[model samples]
Target: MITAAVLAALAMACAMGAWRLTFAKWPWRAPRAAILLWQSLGVTWGLASVGALLAYALEPYGGGVVYGLHAFVDSAVSFGTGHGLLKPYDLPRVSALIAGLTLLAVLVTVLLAAGVQTLRARRRHRVLLALIAHEDPGVPGVRVVDHPGAAAYCLPGLMGSEVVVSAGTLSLLHPDELTAVLAHEAAHARERHDLVLLPFTALNWALPWLSVVRNAHSSVALLVEMAADDRARRYCSPRRLATALLRFGTAGAVPAPDGALGASGEHVMARVNRLVKPGPTFPRHARVSVITFSILLSASAPLLWIYPA
Candidate 1:
C-alpha cells in the first residue's frame, strides 16, 4: 500500500506539472524536446495511476504488481481443486481491482475508438478529394482543390500521404510563400503529427473532468504546429513562411478538414510572430537535461509497478 500511495502521489504531481507546463514559455524555444517531455508526463501519469490502484488491490498477494497479479490469477484458476490456494479478497481489495481494470479498459477503448474515427474521417476526405481535386504542374506533388477559401492541409495515410491547397490560397500567396506553406504541410505529413495528437485526444475523451488534460491537448497541438514550422524553415526562408502565415491569418482561412493537419491552424498569429522575431534556441545542456529527466520519469512508473514492495 505504501508503494501504491507513492504512485498516486507521483500521478498527482504529474497532473499539476502538466497544467503548469501549458503556460510555460520555454516550450516555444525547443518545441520538439518539450513535446517529448509532454509525452513522458502523460504516459507516466496514466501508468502510475493505474499501477497505484492495482498495487493496492494486489498487496495481499505479496511481491510486486506483476508477480502478485500472476499469483492471484494462478490461485483463482486452482480455487475449485483447493490447490495453490490464497486467501479470499476483501471487499475493498476486490473493489480496487475492479476499478483498476475498468479504468484500464476505458483508456484502451477510447484510444482505439479515437484512432478508428480518425481513420474513417480521413478515408472519407480522401475519397472526396480524389473525385474533386486535380494536380497542378506549378505545385508539382500538391493537389489543388478549386475552392475560393484559403486552405492548406495534409491527409496523412499509410500508402501515400498528400498535401492539398485551395485555389484561393494559390491566388493569395506569392510563389515563395506557397513553397513555404507546402513545406509546412509536408513536414506534418512526414512527421506523422496526427499520431502525436491521437493519444491526447483519447486522454481528453477518457478524462474530460480534468482541465489539465484539455490544456495539455491544446498546448501539445500548438507545439506540433511550431515543430512543423521549424521543419518548414529548413526548406524555405523564415520570412516567406511568416508572410504566408500572416496572409492565412488575415485572409479568413478555412480550417483544416477533419483528421487532416493544417498549415495555418492553431494560433497562426502566434506562429507568425515567432517566425518574425525568433527567440533564442534552448541551450543544448538544458534540452539534454530535460530529455533525460523525462525519460527517467517515464521509466520510473514501470519500475515502481514491478519493484517488490
Candidate 2:
C-alpha cells in the first residue's frame, strides 16, 4: 500500500511537470489568451494536488513523515519515563515543545523564502525605476527605461509605473513598430497580468518541487504577452506587432523585471509561427469538451479527497 501511495504521488508530480513544460512550449497567437489558459490549468492542478494530499493523509498509513514524527516523540517520552529522565508532570510540556518546534520550523522556512522573493522583487523594481528615470525623461503618465538589448516593457506598480525599451530595440524598429510594442506593454499593465500571476508565483515559491507550478507561471506569462499583442493588433496591424516581436526577440534583450511584460526567447519562434500561419478556430464541439472537462475536474475534487485508496 505504501509503495502504491508513493508511486501515485510520483506519478502525479511527473504528470504535472510534463504538462507544465508542454503548455509552456506551445505557441499562441495571443499571449494574454495563453496566459488565461495556463492560469486555468494551474488552478486545476493545484486543486487536484491538494485534494489528493488530503485523501492520502486520511488513509491509515497516510500523513507519512508527520505521523512518524508524532509516534517517535510519543515513544521517546514513554521511554524517558521508564528511564527516570522525565517526570509525569513534564509530559505535557515536552509534547508541547516538540509540536511548537515543528510548527515553527515549517513557518520559518516558508516565511524566509517569501521574504527573499519579496526583497528580490523590490530590488528589481528599484533598479528599473532608476534606469527609467535616467533614460526616458519628461514622458508624462509613462516612464520608459533602456535595457542593454532589444525589448520594450511596462512595469505596473502602485505608484511608480514604468515603460522600458532597449537601445538596440530603438535602433532596430520603425516608429510604428515601436508604438505597437509599447501598446502591448500598456495592455499588460491595464489588464493587471502581474496580479493574476500572484497566486501561481506563491505556489512556485512554496512548492518548488512541483515544476507544474513554474511551468504554469511561464505559460501564463507568455499568454499574457500574447494577449497584450492581440490587443495591440486591434490598434495596429498584426504585421506591425509581428515585426516588432521578431526584431526585439532577435536583438536578444532580456526581459525587464519580474512584473514587466517583454518578449521572451522561449516563445519567440512560436510567436513568429503564429503570425505567419494562425490556426483555425476551435469547433463548437471542442469548446464544449473543454468546458466539460473543466467542470468535471472541479466537481471531482471532493470525491477525490474522500474515496478510499
Candidate 3:
C-alpha cells in the first residue's frame, strides 16, 4: 500500500509537471530536449499510474509488485500455495487488478488505433496526390500541385517520402524562400517527425477533454516544427526560412493534408521569431541535467514495481 501511494504520488507529480512545463519559455530554446522531457513525463505518468494499481493489488503477497504478481499468477495457475500467496483473494485486490489491466489495455489499443488511422490517412492523401500532382523539372524530387492556394508539406511513407508544394507557393516566394520551404519539408521526411508526434496525437485522441493532453499535443507539435526549422537552417539562411514562414502565415495558405507535416504549421509567428532573433539554447550542463532527469523519471515507475517497500 505504501508503494502504491508513492507510485500514485509520482504519477500526479508528473501530471503537474507537464502542466507547468506547457507554459515554460525555456522549452522554445531547446525544443528537442524539451520534447524528451515531455515524452518522459507522459510515459512515466502512465506507467506509475498502472504500477500503483498493480502494487495495491499485489500487496498481500509479500515481495514487490513484480515478484508478488508472479507468485499470485503462478498460484492461481498451479493451484498451489507459496510466497504468501495462499491468502484468500479479497474483492478490493481483484478489482484493482482488473482496473489496472483495463487501463493498460486501453492505452495500448488507442495508441495502435491512432497509428493505423494516421497511416491510412497518409496513404489516402498520397494516392490523391499521385492522381493530380506532377513532377517539376526544376524541383527534381518534389511533387507540384496545381492548386492556387499556397501550401507546402511532406507525406511520410514506408516506401519513400514525398515533399509537395502548390503552384501558388511557386509563384509567391522568391527562389531562396522556396529553397528554404523545400529544406523544411525535406527535414520532416528525413527526421520522421510524423512518428515523433504520433504518441501525443494518440493521447489527445484518447483523452480529448484533458487540457494537459491537449497542451502536450499542441506543445509537442510546435516543437516538432521548430526542430524541423532548425534542421532546415543548416541548409539555408535563417532569414530565408523566417521570411518564407512569414509569407505562409500572412497568405493564409491552405494547411497541409491530414497526417502530413507542413513547413508552416502551428504557431508560425513564434517559430519565425525564434529563427529571426535567436534565443540562447540549453547549455551543456543544462542539457545534461535534463537528459539525466528524463532517464530517471522514465525508470522510476519500473523500479517501484521491482523493488520492495
Return the top candidate by lDDT. 1
lDDT of 2 by residue, 1-309 (tens): 342254346437535644755554333533433444445555545444444443333333234334433544575677777953332135554454355455445445665565567557856876757756455443335454454567666766766456666666667778788777778777877787667766666667776886665776666656666677677777887788788777766677675666455645467766666656677754566556545654554445334433344
Q: What is the TM-score of each predicted model, taking all chains together?
A: 0.96, 0.62, 0.93
List ranges where model 3 is wrong by over 4 Å.
78-88
Measured on C-alpha atoms, candidate 3 has an lDDT of 0.90
Per-residue lDDT of 194 in model 3: 91
Task: Show where candidate 1 strays beyond 4 Å.
Answer: 80-88
Best by TM-score: 1
Whole-model Cα lDDT per candidate? 0.91, 0.58, 0.90
lDDT of 1 by residue, 68-121 (tens): 788888888898577766533688888888888888888889999999999999
Task: Give me the overall lDDT of model 1.
Answer: 0.91
Model 3 per-residue lDDT tens digits across residues 52-89: 98889888886878998787777776665433344328
TM-score of 1: 0.96
User: How many backbone collisions does model 1 have?
Assistant: 0
- Sort every candidate by TM-score, greatest first: 1, 3, 2
